[model samples]
Target: MTTIPVTDLLGSLRSGNSTAPRLTWYGPDSERVELSGRVLDNWVAKTSNLLQDELDAEPGMRLRLALPAHWKALVWALAGWQVGLETVLDGGPADFLATDDPAGAVEQHDAVIAVALPALAMRWTGELPAGCFDYAADVRSHGDVFMPHSDPDPSACAVRTQEGRIIRHRELISGFALPHTEGARLHIPADKGLESALANALGAWQQDGSVVLTHPDVALTGKLLADERIHGS
Candidate 1:
């Protein structure tokens, strides 16, 4: 299979089919949110900017993502890769942490980013700890276009998995083990955990395909399959 570099994959998403929905989310209470390629890129750029500018994140720094398998979590992973932070999915020690529970994540990281998972959350619902950065509140203030201070080192570690595997930046696409479905709208179940979700999403996006991510509580019925035009799972 032909593989594109992680950065190049993101570039294609932004420039190739900017208006088409790249990610569709289905949550509880019949809540649905969709992000087109351009919008997804914009969100990633904003988050990347926030990481780089606000947190002083640089290449090789570890970013432990304590988020669930949701749209926002995917955005955080993509942004971390964009800014060259080593994404840690093992709940291990790291330079920074992006999580829904800031109070629980405060002890081990240099900084903590509180994430609000609701589709329309303008800010964190509760009062955050004194030093925590509220993702919803601070991300919008950053630039939509991300200009990295320096190019990422391809040899640097990109992902540190729970099973103690390390995937380097250059290997992310080529080493991706998921089945590829070109131009297919794939459905990814959230119960598979964040790493699997991220891997599947990356494979879909790499092939100019899209993903419909369903929250664990959202059942995958025939109606949903037909409505989302899902071709694969």
Candidate 2:
């Protein structure tokens, strides 16, 4: 398998099917959020800009995601990769942390981002800890396009798993363990956890495919499967 750079994969997503929905989320309370390729790229760009501009993130640094397997978490993972930050999924020391619990995360890291998981959240509902950035509030103010200060080193670590496994940037695509389904719409259950969901989503996107990610509480009904044109779980 050919190794596709994370940067190139993101570019392909933006240019290949700019208007089609690449990631579709089905959450509790009948919530459905769909992000077209262009929109998804814009979100990622804004997030990458935020990480670079606001957080002063650099390549080879670590950004730990204390978030669940939600759409926003997926976006954060992609953005972290775009910024060349080693995305840490484990509870290890990191330069920055993105979490739903701002107060708790602030205690662990100096630079913390409070991420709201709700689809329509404009900002964190409550008061954030001192110095903790509000993801929903701050992300929109960033630029829609991102220009990284430096290219990621392919040999540098890209992801650190909870099980203490490391995956390098060059190995991210080629080393993806999921079964590839070309141009297929895959259904990913959120119950499998963040790392699995991220891997599955990456695998789907790499093949010019799409994903229908469902929250744990959301049932995968027959109508949803048919409506989403899901090829596999």
Candidate 3:
């Protein structure tokens, strides 16, 4: 019997032992977009290549940027960790509203940063400033392979603020833990209007070593079952 920690997911990704399914991205217009696994793989590959190519000079650092509700945003963020780069998500558009222009926004931050602007904003800011990388194009390049400079610490992540970026240096998810063993089955108890019970059960299951799977809507048991795709039985 083997118990696996939540952190193992990151390791499995780095070792090429696993890949994540497409995370659905919901946009502001009530539109949903699904990015393919191949796109994620390529972005990760490109990021790895870029990290190796730039290590002697830039040595990638934590990222800071605002992203639209696009699936590519997830790819970019994950790609950062894939190459041992830290990533900070934008607080929100209100923070961006403070700036008079993109250049001003770029100058306000101390470190090299990449931003994903709204379609209108991207058109307004014709080209990226020198030394700044276009986050989207860089992640999309197909030929590059990401060779990490160091093993990514699962705890390494960042948060954005109007003032600047703060490194959390810890895994971001809170409130629940997911644990697993190779050949056992487990269930996330129906919410039953008991959030605490679900949390406690999840914690105990994680503690006792059980694979956990969940979905956004607890009513849809069929969807939840389909998504669990792993459980190596």
Candidate 4:
């Protein structure tokens, strides 16, 4: 698939080839959830719709992301990028933000989105600030397909890295490790950050591969690999 621009990768996932397993995330408790490219795209769409309809996310908007290395974080990251917003990972200034602690970030950003990190949490049981919006509750009611009013510039800034420098989608896409085209199943250590997770999953998807994500507690042995039919780590 062509991946010069970042949206091309998203386009391929949405329509070009949507039925394959694109990402499989595992929690620390051994719980797992496999998302096909279509399902993943649907999540991105819902998140994008929420960001746009509720938070006024638009091209060039600054979005601060304070999420952990979890599956929902991936959805937020992709959705933010899909809306042509700059992801501020360094806790810098932004127009909108996503964090577990919405109270702290609400003062800085226009709207604060609170994401419950628990695997099966339908909503946050903790007491949230009055202005905070639950990501789980808000995202579920949005549309499943994203149809942008205008295509964003591929050369536009996509992310502000930890070092506080802007990076484009093409630059990020070029850094991936694209392998063969077979449906390769990968088993990965689950301790990596959200950034690493995105890179690893994107690299694997470039090869038409799936993943078997797990925490360190889950020992990855050959027997386990054979049982899961995983081809790589």
Candidate 5:
């Protein structure tokens, strides 16, 4: 078994369990979205292409994620990491910012992205700032398979936060001792921050398993949990 970096884990999942559910998301409006490993990888690929081709996003670029704990938000974060961009959670300086609110972005950002968390809508339908682009709309035109323009050094910094810690891809993946194996379906709450939630979810994926994402805001009963076949409480 080869110990691959977190960046390569998604590709492994796509090839190993292409049709399995990689993530199942529920919105506050009782809307549900299920993305298989292949589908999720397609989205990530498209998003990476959008960032690299259109926005001129390069590896080592700092990106601030201002979206909520939605599935698309996680996809964008993974896409950024795939492009070798550092995902900044701590309100630090960033080269680009992806947010639901254009006004919330800092003035120093070179690019601003508006993400509309649409349940069934494919793209954002509202107006945006002159320079800001709608993520959903723009990503539709990109290719489904992404090829990195330039490979990044694996030992280089992959993520940084106001926590004053920088982590590399190998370190982040190796740090978590996940017990999930291939096709494991793990359930997690949305109360966790993006970093924590993604860490656990990706850890599950690291084992070639999928994640059943849930939220405290959404009413979840024992029946619903059982219906999803969630293994544990």
Candidate 6:
């Protein structure tokens, strides 16, 4: 039996040695979910194809997404990771300009070759700093196949936190502990499995991405997840 590090899972596929797929996200419907299944040899194979067809052809090879802190953005984020690209998660149009310099700060830390922001943010009627692309319509022009230019490298995942500076995959993996409950390991999207209350709780807790605290007086478990804003504050 071999133990695998979750952080290295993406890297394994890029190396063309691993075939097992991992479900990185659930869906809004809870049932109609988005998962990174091993439908091919690896994720990089799919990402590479998509990059070559759509993303790479776009104005900038780099992208910044200004979307809500919902699962859709998470899907986009993971896609960016698969292609070894940089992502700037913005809180939408309201914070667009205010975030522009902050976003530039992120780009300064790394060379942001292209931009991948949501349509709403790009067309917020505010002045764009120049050279920004509309990801919504542009992405549709490309096919769904993900073709990576290179293999997945664990060291490649670079994300910007609100606190300041950059954080890499290596640093991210060592910082957290997995929850012991079954619910903490698997995450069921909010609308999914509503009938299966226990299952929903199990999924949420298993993922360890959510914080489900209890209100003894209310006798209910409150769940929290990472979104555009901080979770479990």
> What lDDT does each candidate get?
0.89, 0.89, 0.39, 0.74, 0.78, 0.35
lDDT string for model 4 (131-179, tens) is: 8889877788899877775566667778887776777766656643334
Give TM-scores for every candidate, taking all chains together and pairing residue i with residue i: 0.96, 0.96, 0.46, 0.86, 0.91, 0.41
Q: Per-residue lDDT for 1-233 in model 5, tens only?
A: 22227557777867976997889987777878999889999989999999999998887788888776779888988888888888888878889899888864546689998888876667777667677788877888999988888775566666675485787756667753345665567887777766766777777888777787776677778887887777764
What would the per-residue lDDT of candidate 3 be over residues 100-193, giving only the tens digit for each residue? 1345464544323354534233322466555555544443443545444455554444333334544343433242333334323344332221
Candidate 3, 102: how far from true, in Å? 3.6
Give the range of the ten consecutive residues with the poorest summed lDDT in model 3.
Answer: 92-101
User: How many steric overlaps does candidate 3 have?
Assistant: 5
**lDDT per residue (tens digit) for residues 1-233 in model 2:** 22327888888989997899899999999999999889999999999999999989998999999998999999999999988889998889999999997775677775999999999999999898888999999999999998888777888899999998999988888875365778979888999999999998889888898899999999898999999998655
Per-residue C-alpha lDDT of model 6 across residues 8-81, encoded as one tens digit per residue: 43344334323322233322223222233343223334333444553342211343544333333434444554
TM-score of 4: 0.86
Model 1 regions more than 4 Å off = 1-4
In angstroms, the error of model 5 at 108 is 2.7
In model 4, which runs have C-alpha deviations exceeding 4 angstroms?
1-4, 176-183, 216-224
Model 6 residue 36 distance off true place after TM-score fit, in angstroms: 8.5
- Candidate order by TM-score, decreasing, is 2, 1, 5, 4, 3, 6
Q: Write down the RMSD of all candidates, one decimal each.
A: 2.6, 2.2, 9.7, 3.0, 2.5, 11.0
